[model samples]
Target: MSDATLMLSGIEKSYNRGTPGEVSVLRGVDLSVQRGEVVALVAPSGAGKSTLLHIAGLLDVADTGRVEIAGQDLTDLSDTRRTATRRADVGFIYQFHHLLPEFSALENIVLPQLAHGVPRAQAQTRAQDLLDRVGIAARADHRPAALSGGEQQRVAFCRALANEPKLLLADEPTGNLDPETSDQVFAALMDLVRGTGLSALIATHNMELAARMDRQIRLEAGQLIPLGGAQRPA
Candidate 1:
């Protein structure tokens, strides 16, 4: 078993396969995210970054390839096992804060843990700790509608980390915010991730944010290309 937290090999995905309009999005995409390392995925729209994330997070299957998490080969897991693995090992965030409207900020974070079979009392404690870590503890009882954009997104971040997953997959996490708020929220997110010592593969169009990650990679021509001094994963 390798030390990588997430590994993808020979990944290939295409929409409308076998049809004239068939569009290949990912072509032999390979990536490896080491334990506790944060890697930025830099790509423009339509570059298939989201598709890659979905595959890596087990939310979607690749047309062909292998997906591994924590050195375990998950590519062939049954749907039930995949779901179990995903819930246990992967955390995901997106451009928008998808908190449930009726749930308070703390409740939003507690819900996933409860679903994972954590006792309600223990789940609430963990959720409150997460919210506190993200600097949103004061807003725990507020619903999404009551919080500011930054506060709402912070709640979303806490919710993502609720399960203490080994790997985090974030797609444009701060993209929906204004410039200043984006910077602040991104900082909060980085702090949370680093403090937890979790590995993350975050997709972003902002070069500045990408530079803050441990390494950067870009998707081009349907393949991942290492950027700057980052070495390609063997």
Candidate 2:
């Protein structure tokens, strides 16, 4: 086992295999994200960003190659075992909040922890603390319908972190927000992630946000390209 928080090597994925309409999303893609390191994955809308993210998060599998998180190789795990590993080691966020319509903000955050075997009292405490960190403790009792876009995304962030996963994978988390709200929400997310020392691989079309990450990589023609020479803000 290695120390990387997330690693993918020689990954390949295609749809409608052995057919005339087959589409290849990932081809021999390889990347590694270290513990406490944040990496930005930049690509166009039709690129394979989401495909790569799903594979990394274990929400989906690659046709071939390795998927490892916290030094554990998951490519060969049974579906049940892979799901267990995902719940234990990976946290995911998406463009939509996806909060339960009937649950209060705090409850939405607490549920995942509870499922992961956290005590109810402890989960509630952690949920409140997470809301406070995002400056939304006052909104913790409100349901998603009552909160604004930014607030709902913040709650989603809290829910994703509730299980205390080692790695966080986000796909355009702020893509649904207006520019101003997106900036605020992204800042809140960064602060929370840094405070917890969690590794992250975030996919985004927003170059400004990508530049803020510790490292940046791009997907082109089904391959990962390091952008070490790219200029980023000082």
Candidate 3:
């Protein structure tokens, strides 16, 4: 595969394949997302963008082929081992803010670090710094219930970043906000990740955003291909 922070080779996935209800989500898809690179995935609904993100993040296993994270093949690992690998290496961002409603912004970001056994003092410091960078330090004490949609998403970005992951997976991160708020949140998210040497694969329907990233790929009929296919360039 290409020199990448993440790789999925010859992957095939389907469900209920023996009957008329059968559906194939990905077919022999091969992809390589290199380190420190940001790639956008743009596709129509039902094209399996989310499915491909899930498989790449190790949240769900592929039915065939190999998945590699920083050169370690995970297709052979058990569920428990896979979970451990993901916790340490990958970060996820979703369209909706998945922050814990009961926890304050700072607490929400720190909780994952605590789960991984990081020192409470260090976790707090890092979480605070992340919040500040995301422009949410002022809202650090507020719970999700008290925050606006954009504010909450900003907090989620901090939470996703607290671990300093090798690769990031985002699914329509700005999908729920208005144009202005979405731009603000997206700016903060990119700024927080700037100079971090992190790799990212983001699924988006926004053509402008797709064009801004290092590369763009499309999902169609369960296959992954370059944007505009072979007509674009050599």
Please provide, for model 3 over 110-160, each residue's C-alpha lDDT reduced to its tens digit, 9 standing for 90 to 100.
999998889999999999999888877889999999999999998888888
User: Backbone clashes in each candidate structure, one number apiece?
Assistant: 0, 0, 0
Give the winner by lDDT: 1
How well is each residue in 1-234 modelled by candidate 2, as lDDT tens digits?
A: 566999899999999999999999898998999888889999888789999999999889899999888877789899999889899898999999999999999999999998999999999999999999999999998999999999999999999999999999999999999999999999999999998999999998898888888898999888898886233233
How well does each candidate superpose onto the true structure, as a TM-score?
0.96, 0.96, 0.94
Q: Runs in model 3 with CA error above 4 Å?
A: 228-234
Off by over 4 Å in 1: 229-234
Question: Model 1: per-residue lDDT, tens digit, 1-234?
Answer: 589999999999999999999999999998999998899999989989999999999999999999999999999999999999999999999999999999999899999999999999999999999888888898899999999999999998888999999999999999999999999999999999989999999999999988888899999989999996343333
Q: What is the C-alpha local distance difference test score of each model?
A: 0.93, 0.92, 0.87
Between which residue pairs do clashes occur in model 3? Answer: none
Residue pairs in clash, model 2: none
**Total clashes for model 3:** 0
